[model samples]
Target: METSAYLNAVVEQTNTLAGWVHGRDATAPVPTCPKWTLADLVDHVGATQRMVAMLVGERMTEPDSAYARYVPAPGDPAQWRDWLTGTAAEAEQAFASVTDDTPVWDPSGAAAGVPFWSRRLFGEACVHRADAAAALGLPYELAPELAVAAIEDWLDTLTSRGYWENRPDFADAMRGSGQTLHFHATDASGEWLARREPDRVVLERTHTKADITVRGPAADLLLVLSRRRPLSATPTLELHGDRTLIDRWIEHMDWVTGD
Candidate 1:
């Protein structure tokens, strides 16, 4: 996705969130995020936007210092909608001001650039928007392009050797004798094959057989991968082959923590 598309997605998702929670109960529980209320989820998105703005806008080189300088919004639920929208705009301007190749701090030690941060912010906004939807009992929808990009970015993160270096437990659990988990977006030209190797997780964009296959619209697949909803419960998703393999993959994937 282009930087502009990511920025637009961030705006759309955050704006949808603001509208969804408007005049609703701030203390409503987000089923997807058991520990956070509606207000807490909004605050999380706003703070994340501000942090990304600082990281990309200021071109901060160190993660710790950048995080240390971060600030949270005031504890006022009534003003959260305005705060969320303001931070989204701030993130948009920050990303737009820099070229995609510009260097930046990335906590995960993945590829660090303006493009990476923009994509990260968009994924954050998209998934959290799903959280809000679950909390409010509203249906959620995402553009096919945005959904595909999100799933790709997330899979890259999950399979990154750099990321797994710090997550030995997950790495160990995910290792297998060439078992594969396939994901097919039936509604669009999106397809991927994830193979669990003895030492690492290998991912590829291809159409092939696997131990298990998940077929659905790109948006629903994104949600299932995000673990905001279960694959078995969502009728829109079709599962073929070994259910245990996919279940095990999802179980291990749950340990990959990020907004």
Candidate 2:
């Protein structure tokens, strides 16, 4: 996806999230994030962007969450929208100011500049937007190309968390002698072969043989691989090859759940 598209997603998804919050009780529990309330998820989406803007936008050499704090207006949907708008604008401006080649600090050390953070934030907002829609019983969707970008960004982010965040639980689970997982999206031009290992995990952007392969639309694939949607409940999602391997990956792959 283009950088403009990602920034656009950040704006649009902010609207979707605000609608979900305005339509439902803020206290509604998010199935995707068991520990988070609907409001928490909403706040998370906005606050995270604000934080990113502080780090990447403001060119803060050191990251800090406190710089991005946004206090929501109580009982006013317009206020919520305003908050999202301002925060998202900050992020967009900062990202749009830089080129792809501009060096920036990324936790994973695998990404650089506006391209990495824009793509990363887009995926985060997309997934959490789905969470909001799921909680409110509203429908969710993403552009084909954007969805593919989200999935690819998600895998990269997950690998970063697994190896860098010191999530020993996830790190231990991701290791294997030579197991592979294939993510195939039927709706868009998306295919990935993930070679899992402890020392050096590789995410190949191609169609290759794997011990297990999960096939679905880009949106569903993102939810499933992120563990937000169950592989069993989604009929559109198909699983083939070694089920055990897929299960192992799904079970401990999510860092959010602290599994």
Candidate 3:
């Protein structure tokens, strides 16, 4: 996806997140996040926007003290929507000041520039927006293209060695002797094949045989892949192969749970 597309999706998802919590209880527990209240989630979204804004707008090549010491606002539902929207607008303006190729600090160093930040922030907001919705007991929906982009970005992260640098044991657990998993989006023309290699997990955009294949709407697939929902509980997806392989992937994939 282009940088602009990602930025636009961030705006839309941020708005949706704000709407979910508008006039609602800030203290509401987010079942998906497990540890955060509604207000914590909102503050997280705003802080992330600010962090990326500072990174891209200032064109910093490294983390600054400000990024490290910043804190989230208190849980105040009456004001959280406005605060969240304001921060998103701040991020949008900051992103607008630079080209996609503009240099910026990336902790992983696997990807750099505004494009990376754009995609990163988009994923952060998109996944957390779903968390907010699930918390509020409201139905969630995302455009197929947006969901596809989210899935692709996540797969890209999995394929990056930098992501697993701190968790070598988990990385070793993920590697296998040519085991493969397929993800097929029934609502859109998106498909992916992920194969476990001794050194890393390789992902390709294609349709083929696999040890396990998850077929579903793009949004549902995003939720399951991101660990927001359990594959066994989600009725939208169809399992066509080794269920244990998918379960193992979910057991090791801990992006959302902070494990």
Candidate 4:
């Protein structure tokens, strides 16, 4: 969507996530992110917001080696809600002050502009919000528009030759001849065909069937595509044709480590 919409999601998602943190088990495991507990996720989400806020606010053209200005919050988990909401507002304001074309640094080597953060940060917030929902046994939902945009942004990262060049294992895993994975979002006008070639993966918008088809609402597909949720675990996602190809795609080519 637009920049304002993304910023709105950042605020909405982080606040919702903060609300979930209150009176909950801080040590609870996030099934989606095996490496983090509820507390870790909160810290990550909030800290990342502050960091991105700094980056956008300064119009940084290169990566910062240190963000020591940000210290760990001292209070118990009960205090996290306030901290998270404050950071989210700071980030929202910073993101709003910058224009889409405003130049900035990005660790992913993607676009050198605030637009990149707006897109990536929104997807990150959406995926992690899903994580919090799963941890709390609460139903998770997303706007179809956000889901479609998120999937599109994430696919841009995945298929980017410049991005995977730094991760040889991921690059190698994406290479194959004639194998394709099709993602169809039933709830919105989102359909993508991912074709694997000998050298790189290519993404396009189309209806032609691939070796496998993943059909669902854009939100569900976004969650699965983001690697926060697996395609097989949810019977809600309609998986037709080669399950192995879809499984392999999820195994190696589905994750993006970013804020």
Candidate 5:
């Protein structure tokens, strides 16, 4: 998808989530996030969006206190909503002005640039939108291309600098096997293969059957791979060679990079 389209999707989803928060009972708990109320969910996502916007806009190399300057206090419904909508607008505008290839530091160590933030923000907003929707028993939907790209970005981050420090166990598990796990999106013609190596997990776009084959809609597959949704939700997934390998892969995988 074009950079603007990705930004549009992020903005649309963020607005949808903001609308949900505005309409929801402030005291209600979020089902997917368990410990959070609707207000808290809004706060978390809004805070993250603000953080990313600062990181990219300021070319930040370290965490900044500016991102936390507007954090909402508990039970502050009006402030929470304001933060969500306000920060989302700031992020949307920051993302809209950049070209895909403009360089920036992504702690995830994926491809650096406006495209990285574009894809990351879109995926983050969309997934949290799903979280909010699930909390309200509403249906969730995502663009197929956006879903596929999100999965790719996440996997790249997980196997690179991002995962190494936070999830050593997972990183160790993925090493030296030379084995591969393939994800095929039945609806979008999207395919990804992750190959295990002594040094790092090497990911690429491919279609050949590997040790396991996860099959689903692009969005569903992305959610499952991201651990936002359970694997049982995707019965369409075909386990080719070793189901245990796939199970272990998911169990040990860590998505966030950089401690």
Candidate 6:
């Protein structure tokens, strides 16, 4: 997808999420994220969006110190929502002004340019939008292409340097099997196959099934793979081959790549 489209989707999803947060039914629990209430989920997502916007827009070298200055303290829900909406608007404007090829640091050493943040922010906002919706017992929807790309990004990010270093257990489990895991999106014809090797986890787009198969709508599959929503939560998912392998894969999956 084009960078403009992705950025636009981020803005749209953020706006939708804000509305959900302000709804009367906002007290509901987010089943996807067990420990957080709808309000807490909104605050968390808002804080994350603001932090990422700062990291990419200002080109900060150390994120913790810089991000801490802008983040809302715990229990400050109103302030947090205000910051989220304001920062999301700022991020939208900043991204809208740039071209896809504009130079940007690849904090993860994976890819460079504005497109990376465009895509990352898009997926981040989209998935959390689903989280907010699921929390409010509302329907979740995403652009087909965006959903597919989110899944791809999730897989790629999990195997990247940041995830491996932080989640050693996950990395070990991922490396335990020489077997591969395949994700097939039935609606959009999107596919991803990942193989574990000694040196690195290799991934590619292919139709062939691996040792396990995760088949469902692109959006549901994306949520399931992201661990934002459980597979059993959705009726449409079809798990072929070993269920335990799929569980292991999900247990080890990482959402974000960089520290």
- The digit string of per-residue lDDT tens for model 3 on 8-28 reads 888888988887788798788
Error of 2 at 50 (Å): 0.7
Q: Model 5 off-target regions past 4 Å?
A: 65-70, 78-82, 100-103, 253-259
The root-mean-square deviation over C-alpha atoms between each candidate and the true structure, in angstroms, is 1.9, 2.4, 1.7, 2.4, 3.1, 3.3
For each candidate, what TM-score against the reference?
0.93, 0.90, 0.93, 0.90, 0.85, 0.85
* Candidates, ranked, lDDT: 1, 3, 4, 2, 5, 6
Q: Which scores greater on lDDT, model 3 or model 4?
A: 3
Residue 205 C-alpha lDDT in model 5: 87
What's each prediction's clash count? 0, 0, 0, 0, 3, 0
> What is the C-alpha local distance difference test score of candidate 2?
0.76
Off by over 4 Å in 2: 65-78, 161-165, 257-259
| Predicted candidate 1, C-alpha RMSD | 1.9
The total of clashing pairs for model 3 equals: 0
Model 2's C-alpha root-mean-square deviation from the true structure amounts to: 2.4
List the lowest-lDDT window of 10 residues for candidate 4.
250-259
TM-score-best of 1 and 5: 1
TM-score for predicted model 1 compared with the true structure: 0.93
lDDT value, candidate 5, whole model: 0.72
Which model is ahead, 1 or 2, in terms of lDDT? 1
Over 53-156, each residue of candidate 6 has an lDDT whose tens digit, in order, gives 66667655556755576765245444444555676777777776666665556555555557767777777888788887776778888877779988876777
Indicate the residue-level lDDT of 19 in model 5: 72
Q: How close is candidate 6 to the true structure, as a TM-score?
A: 0.85
Misplaced by over 4 Å in model 3 are none
**Per-residue lDDT over 1-259 for candidate 5, one digit per residue giving the tens place of the 0 to 100 score:** 6667777777788877877777557767766666777777776788778777776666555555555565553365655555677787888777765556656666565546677677778777877787788778878888787787777767766766666656778777878668888888877868888888887888888888687777778888877786667787777555567777777777664343111
